[model samples]
Target: MTKNVMVLVDEQHRLDSVTAAVEACGVRVQRVMRGMRTIVGAVSDDAAIERVQQMDGVASVREEKSFAVPPNHRDIPQ
Candidate 1:
Protein backbone atom coordinates (compact mmCIF):
# COMPACT_ATOMS: atom_id res chain seq x y z
CA MET A 1 0.00 0.00 0.00
CA THR A 2 1.09 3.53 -0.75
CA LYS A 3 1.50 5.94 2.11
CA ASN A 4 1.63 9.74 2.12
CA VAL A 5 4.21 11.16 4.48
CA MET A 6 5.79 14.40 5.66
CA VAL A 7 9.59 14.31 5.81
CA LEU A 8 11.66 16.81 7.74
CA VAL A 9 15.28 17.34 6.75
CA ASP A 10 17.95 17.65 9.39
CA GLU A 11 19.29 21.16 9.94
CA GLN A 12 22.89 19.98 9.66
CA HIS A 13 22.25 18.46 6.25
CA ARG A 14 21.50 19.81 2.78
CA LEU A 15 18.04 19.27 1.32
CA ASP A 16 19.33 18.34 -2.14
CA SER A 17 21.45 15.43 -0.94
CA VAL A 18 18.77 14.24 1.44
CA THR A 19 16.16 14.36 -1.32
CA ALA A 20 18.24 12.23 -3.63
CA ALA A 21 18.87 9.75 -0.82
CA VAL A 22 15.14 9.63 -0.02
CA GLU A 23 14.23 8.87 -3.63
CA ALA A 24 16.80 6.11 -3.64
CA CYS A 25 14.99 4.67 -0.66
CA GLY A 26 11.77 4.52 -2.69
CA VAL A 27 9.95 7.74 -1.76
CA ARG A 28 8.09 9.32 -4.61
CA VAL A 29 8.72 12.93 -3.67
CA GLN A 30 5.76 15.14 -4.50
CA ARG A 31 6.81 18.48 -3.08
CA VAL A 32 9.80 20.16 -1.51
CA MET A 33 9.67 22.95 1.07
CA ARG A 34 13.19 24.35 1.28
CA GLY A 35 12.24 27.06 3.76
CA MET A 36 10.88 24.57 6.25
CA ARG A 37 13.25 21.73 5.35
CA THR A 38 10.22 19.56 4.74
CA ILE A 39 9.31 17.22 1.91
CA VAL A 40 5.91 15.77 1.17
CA GLY A 41 6.06 12.42 -0.53
CA ALA A 42 4.81 8.86 -0.86
CA VAL A 43 6.25 5.35 -0.62
CA SER A 44 5.19 2.07 -2.11
CA ASP A 45 4.84 0.23 1.19
CA ASP A 46 5.74 -0.03 4.83
CA ALA A 47 9.21 -1.34 4.09
CA ALA A 48 9.96 1.64 1.90
CA ILE A 49 8.71 3.94 4.62
CA GLU A 50 11.00 2.22 7.05
CA ARG A 51 13.95 2.71 4.74
CA VAL A 52 13.21 6.40 4.48
CA GLN A 53 12.99 6.71 8.25
CA GLN A 54 16.43 5.20 8.72
CA MET A 55 18.15 7.51 6.25
CA ASP A 56 21.04 9.78 7.36
CA GLY A 57 19.58 13.25 6.67
CA VAL A 58 15.98 12.61 7.57
CA ALA A 59 15.01 14.28 10.82
CA SER A 60 11.51 12.81 10.89
CA VAL A 61 8.92 10.97 8.85
CA ARG A 62 5.27 11.24 9.76
CA GLU A 63 2.44 9.58 7.95
CA GLU A 64 -0.22 11.92 6.62
CA LYS A 65 -3.58 11.76 8.38
CA SER A 66 -6.93 12.33 6.71
CA PHE A 67 -10.15 13.63 8.20
CA ALA A 68 -13.64 14.09 6.82
CA VAL A 69 -16.38 16.55 7.73
CA PRO A 70 -19.81 15.40 8.86
CA PRO A 71 -22.50 14.86 6.27
CA ASN A 72 -25.04 17.58 5.45
CA HIS A 73 -27.72 16.85 7.99
CA ARG A 74 -29.28 19.15 10.54
CA ASP A 75 -29.76 16.24 12.93
CA ILE A 76 -26.07 15.65 13.25
CA PRO A 77 -24.41 16.77 16.47
CA GLN A 78 -22.21 19.83 16.39
Candidate 2:
Protein backbone atom coordinates (compact mmCIF):
# COMPACT_ATOMS: atom_id res chain seq x y z
CA MET A 1 0.00 0.00 0.00
CA THR A 2 1.05 3.56 -0.71
CA LYS A 3 1.18 6.26 1.95
CA ASN A 4 0.40 9.89 1.28
CA VAL A 5 1.99 12.48 3.59
CA MET A 6 1.60 16.21 3.80
CA VAL A 7 4.16 18.35 5.53
CA LEU A 8 3.91 21.91 6.78
CA VAL A 9 7.40 23.35 6.69
CA ASP A 10 9.25 26.52 7.45
CA GLU A 11 9.38 28.74 4.41
CA GLN A 12 12.47 30.56 5.67
CA HIS A 13 14.55 27.49 5.01
CA ARG A 14 14.89 26.36 1.43
CA LEU A 15 13.18 23.00 1.01
CA ASP A 16 16.07 21.76 -1.12
CA SER A 17 17.60 19.81 1.76
CA VAL A 18 14.33 18.12 2.68
CA THR A 19 13.49 17.54 -0.95
CA ALA A 20 16.81 15.88 -1.53
CA ALA A 21 16.32 13.61 1.47
CA VAL A 22 12.82 12.59 0.40
CA GLU A 23 13.99 11.92 -3.15
CA ALA A 24 16.85 9.87 -1.78
CA CYS A 25 14.26 7.70 -0.02
CA GLY A 26 12.71 6.99 -3.43
CA VAL A 27 9.43 8.72 -2.70
CA ARG A 28 7.58 10.73 -5.34
CA VAL A 29 6.90 14.29 -4.30
CA GLN A 30 3.90 15.42 -6.28
CA ARG A 31 3.40 19.09 -5.32
CA VAL A 32 4.94 21.75 -3.11
CA MET A 33 2.50 24.53 -2.33
CA ARG A 34 4.58 27.66 -1.73
CA GLY A 35 1.70 29.66 -0.36
CA MET A 36 1.06 27.20 2.44
CA ARG A 37 4.64 26.08 2.71
CA THR A 38 3.38 22.55 2.46
CA ILE A 39 4.56 19.52 0.48
CA VAL A 40 2.61 16.54 -0.84
CA GLY A 41 4.42 13.26 -1.39
CA ALA A 42 3.75 9.54 -1.61
CA VAL A 43 5.68 6.64 -0.15
CA SER A 44 5.18 2.93 0.27
CA ASP A 45 5.69 3.09 4.01
CA ASP A 46 4.49 5.38 6.81
CA ALA A 47 8.02 5.47 8.22
CA ALA A 48 8.98 7.58 5.23
CA ILE A 49 6.55 10.21 6.41
CA GLU A 50 8.17 10.23 9.82
CA ARG A 51 11.57 10.63 8.24
CA VAL A 52 10.37 13.51 6.14
CA GLN A 53 9.06 15.31 9.20
CA GLN A 54 12.30 14.75 11.05
CA MET A 55 14.13 16.74 8.38
CA ASP A 56 15.32 20.20 9.38
CA GLY A 57 12.78 23.02 9.27
CA VAL A 58 9.71 20.82 9.21
CA ALA A 59 6.93 22.20 11.41
CA SER A 60 4.48 19.32 11.24
CA VAL A 61 3.36 16.29 9.25
CA ARG A 62 -0.05 14.87 8.45
CA GLU A 63 -1.34 11.81 6.65
CA GLU A 64 -3.90 11.93 3.87
CA LYS A 65 -7.01 9.77 4.21
CA SER A 66 -10.60 9.39 3.14
CA PHE A 67 -13.13 12.08 3.95
CA ALA A 68 -16.82 12.81 3.51
CA VAL A 69 -18.60 15.96 2.36
CA PRO A 70 -22.19 16.95 1.66
CA PRO A 71 -23.24 16.28 -1.91
CA ASN A 72 -25.04 19.59 -2.16
CA HIS A 73 -22.32 21.65 -0.51
CA ARG A 74 -22.48 25.34 -1.36
CA ASP A 75 -19.57 26.58 0.74
CA ILE A 76 -16.79 28.31 -1.27
CA PRO A 77 -19.06 28.13 -4.28
CA GLN A 78 -17.68 29.26 -7.58
Candidate 3:
Protein backbone atom coordinates (compact mmCIF):
# COMPACT_ATOMS: atom_id res chain seq x y z
CA MET A 1 0.00 0.00 0.00
CA THR A 2 1.12 3.53 -0.67
CA LYS A 3 1.68 5.88 2.23
CA ASN A 4 2.17 9.60 2.62
CA VAL A 5 5.40 10.97 4.06
CA MET A 6 6.83 14.30 5.05
CA VAL A 7 10.52 14.91 4.48
CA LEU A 8 12.14 17.88 6.16
CA VAL A 9 15.37 19.18 4.70
CA ASP A 10 17.32 22.08 6.09
CA GLU A 11 20.11 22.21 3.55
CA GLN A 12 19.40 23.62 0.13
CA HIS A 13 21.94 21.45 -1.70
CA ARG A 14 20.32 18.30 -0.42
CA LEU A 15 17.03 19.09 -2.08
CA ASP A 16 17.99 17.86 -5.50
CA SER A 17 19.70 14.75 -4.25
CA VAL A 18 16.81 13.83 -2.03
CA THR A 19 14.30 14.45 -4.76
CA ALA A 20 16.25 12.33 -7.17
CA ALA A 21 16.50 9.46 -4.74
CA VAL A 22 12.79 9.44 -4.05
CA GLU A 23 11.87 9.76 -7.68
CA ALA A 24 14.15 6.86 -8.56
CA CYS A 25 12.06 4.73 -6.26
CA GLY A 26 8.85 5.68 -8.08
CA VAL A 27 7.74 8.12 -5.42
CA ARG A 28 5.96 11.29 -6.40
CA VAL A 29 6.28 14.67 -4.78
CA GLN A 30 2.80 15.89 -4.00
CA ARG A 31 3.62 19.27 -2.47
CA VAL A 32 6.50 21.24 -1.12
CA MET A 33 6.06 23.58 1.84
CA ARG A 34 8.70 26.19 2.46
CA GLY A 35 8.94 28.12 5.67
CA MET A 36 11.91 28.79 7.92
CA ARG A 37 12.79 25.39 6.43
CA THR A 38 11.55 23.05 3.72
CA ILE A 39 8.94 20.34 4.06
CA VAL A 40 8.28 17.92 1.20
CA GLY A 41 5.11 15.92 0.82
CA ALA A 42 5.53 12.63 -1.07
CA VAL A 43 3.63 9.45 -1.68
CA SER A 44 5.53 6.21 -1.35
CA ASP A 45 6.10 3.20 0.85
CA ASP A 46 8.03 3.13 4.14
CA ALA A 47 11.30 2.54 2.30
CA ALA A 48 11.07 5.98 0.79
CA ILE A 49 11.32 7.57 4.22
CA GLU A 50 14.57 5.73 4.87
CA ARG A 51 15.96 6.68 1.50
CA VAL A 52 15.11 10.34 1.99
CA GLN A 53 16.80 10.48 5.37
CA GLN A 54 19.99 8.94 4.03
CA MET A 55 20.43 11.77 1.57
CA ASP A 56 23.37 14.11 2.14
CA GLY A 57 21.48 17.00 3.73
CA VAL A 58 18.14 15.73 4.87
CA ALA A 59 17.34 16.93 8.38
CA SER A 60 14.61 14.37 8.99
CA VAL A 61 11.80 12.32 7.47
CA ARG A 62 8.67 10.82 8.92
CA GLU A 63 5.44 9.16 7.96
CA GLU A 64 2.57 11.62 7.87
CA LYS A 65 -1.17 11.24 7.62
CA SER A 66 -3.71 13.48 5.95
CA PHE A 67 -5.05 16.09 8.29
CA ALA A 68 -7.38 19.03 7.90
CA VAL A 69 -6.02 21.61 5.50
CA PRO A 70 -4.83 24.76 7.21
CA PRO A 71 -7.57 27.42 7.13
CA ASN A 72 -5.28 30.31 6.32
CA HIS A 73 -5.44 29.62 2.60
CA ARG A 74 -8.28 29.22 0.14
CA ASP A 75 -8.56 28.00 -3.44
CA ILE A 76 -8.54 30.68 -6.12
CA PRO A 77 -9.71 28.86 -9.21
CA GLN A 78 -8.63 30.39 -12.41
Candidate 4:
Protein backbone atom coordinates (compact mmCIF):
# COMPACT_ATOMS: atom_id res chain seq x y z
CA MET A 1 0.00 0.00 0.00
CA THR A 2 1.24 3.46 -0.87
CA LYS A 3 1.57 6.10 1.85
CA ASN A 4 1.99 9.84 1.76
CA VAL A 5 4.63 11.32 4.06
CA MET A 6 6.19 14.59 5.14
CA VAL A 7 9.89 14.58 6.02
CA LEU A 8 11.53 17.21 8.19
CA VAL A 9 15.20 17.84 7.46
CA ASP A 10 17.83 18.59 10.02
CA GLU A 11 19.79 21.84 9.92
CA GLN A 12 23.15 20.13 9.65
CA HIS A 13 22.49 18.65 6.22
CA ARG A 14 21.76 20.16 2.85
CA LEU A 15 18.24 19.76 1.49
CA ASP A 16 19.58 18.47 -1.82
CA SER A 17 21.43 15.61 -0.19
CA VAL A 18 18.43 14.72 1.93
CA THR A 19 16.09 14.94 -1.03
CA ALA A 20 18.36 12.65 -2.98
CA ALA A 21 18.38 10.24 -0.09
CA VAL A 22 14.58 10.35 0.14
CA GLU A 23 14.20 9.68 -3.57
CA ALA A 24 16.65 6.82 -3.27
CA CYS A 25 14.33 5.29 -0.70
CA GLY A 26 11.60 4.89 -3.35
CA VAL A 27 9.65 8.02 -2.46
CA ARG A 28 7.96 9.74 -5.34
CA VAL A 29 8.64 13.34 -4.45
CA GLN A 30 5.63 15.63 -4.81
CA ARG A 31 6.98 19.03 -3.80
CA VAL A 32 9.86 20.46 -1.77
CA MET A 33 9.26 23.04 0.97
CA ARG A 34 12.73 24.52 1.42
CA GLY A 35 11.66 27.33 3.73
CA MET A 36 10.08 24.88 6.14
CA ARG A 37 12.86 22.30 5.88
CA THR A 38 10.29 19.76 4.79
CA ILE A 39 9.87 17.39 1.89
CA VAL A 40 6.49 16.08 0.80
CA GLY A 41 6.48 12.70 -0.90
CA ALA A 42 4.84 9.31 -1.21
CA VAL A 43 6.31 5.90 -0.45
CA SER A 44 5.39 2.34 -1.31
CA ASP A 45 4.75 1.13 2.25
CA ASP A 46 5.88 1.06 5.88
CA ALA A 47 9.26 -0.33 4.90
CA ALA A 48 9.94 2.61 2.66
CA ILE A 49 9.05 5.06 5.39
CA GLU A 50 11.43 3.30 7.76
CA ARG A 51 14.21 3.56 5.23
CA VAL A 52 13.59 7.27 4.87
CA GLN A 53 13.54 7.75 8.65
CA GLN A 54 16.92 6.07 8.96
CA MET A 55 18.56 8.47 6.54
CA ASP A 56 21.21 10.70 8.13
CA GLY A 57 19.65 14.09 7.40
CA VAL A 58 16.08 13.20 8.24
CA ALA A 59 14.71 14.73 11.42
CA SER A 60 11.25 13.23 11.29
CA VAL A 61 8.96 11.30 9.01
CA ARG A 62 5.20 11.50 9.41
CA GLU A 63 2.16 10.42 7.48
CA GLU A 64 0.29 13.12 5.65
CA LYS A 65 -3.37 13.57 6.45
CA SER A 66 -5.93 14.54 3.88
CA PHE A 67 -9.28 16.18 4.49
CA ALA A 68 -12.18 16.66 2.13
CA VAL A 69 -15.66 18.15 2.33
CA PRO A 70 -18.64 16.35 0.83
CA PRO A 71 -20.35 18.15 -2.00
CA ASN A 72 -23.82 17.08 -0.85
CA HIS A 73 -23.67 18.04 2.80
CA ARG A 74 -27.07 18.32 4.53
CA ASP A 75 -25.94 21.45 6.37
CA ILE A 76 -25.44 23.32 3.10
CA PRO A 77 -28.15 24.14 0.56
CA GLN A 78 -27.74 21.75 -2.31
Query: Model 2 over residues 15-38: C-alpha lDDT tens digits?
Result: 767666666665678998877877
TM-score for each model? 0.81, 0.71, 0.59, 0.81
Output the number of the lDDT-best candidate: 4
User: What C-alpha lDDT does candidate 4 achieve relative to the native structure?
Assistant: 0.91
Candidate 2 weakest lDDT stretch, 10 residues? 69-78
How much lDDT does each candidate structure score? 0.90, 0.75, 0.65, 0.91
RMSD of 2: 4.1
lDDT of 4 by residue, 4-62 (tens): 89999999999999999899998999999999999998988888898998899999998
How much is 11 displaced in model 3, in angstroms? 3.1
lDDT of 3 by residue, 1-78 (tens): 777776676666656666666567556777666553455566646776777677766777777766564556467433
lDDT of 2 at 24: 69
Q: Which model, 1 or 2, shows the larger lDDT?
A: 1
Clashing pairs in 2: none
Q: Model 1, residue 1: what's the lDDT?
A: 81
Q: Give the residue spans of candidate 2 off by over 4 A.
A: 71-78
Candidate 4: give the clashing pairs. Answer: none
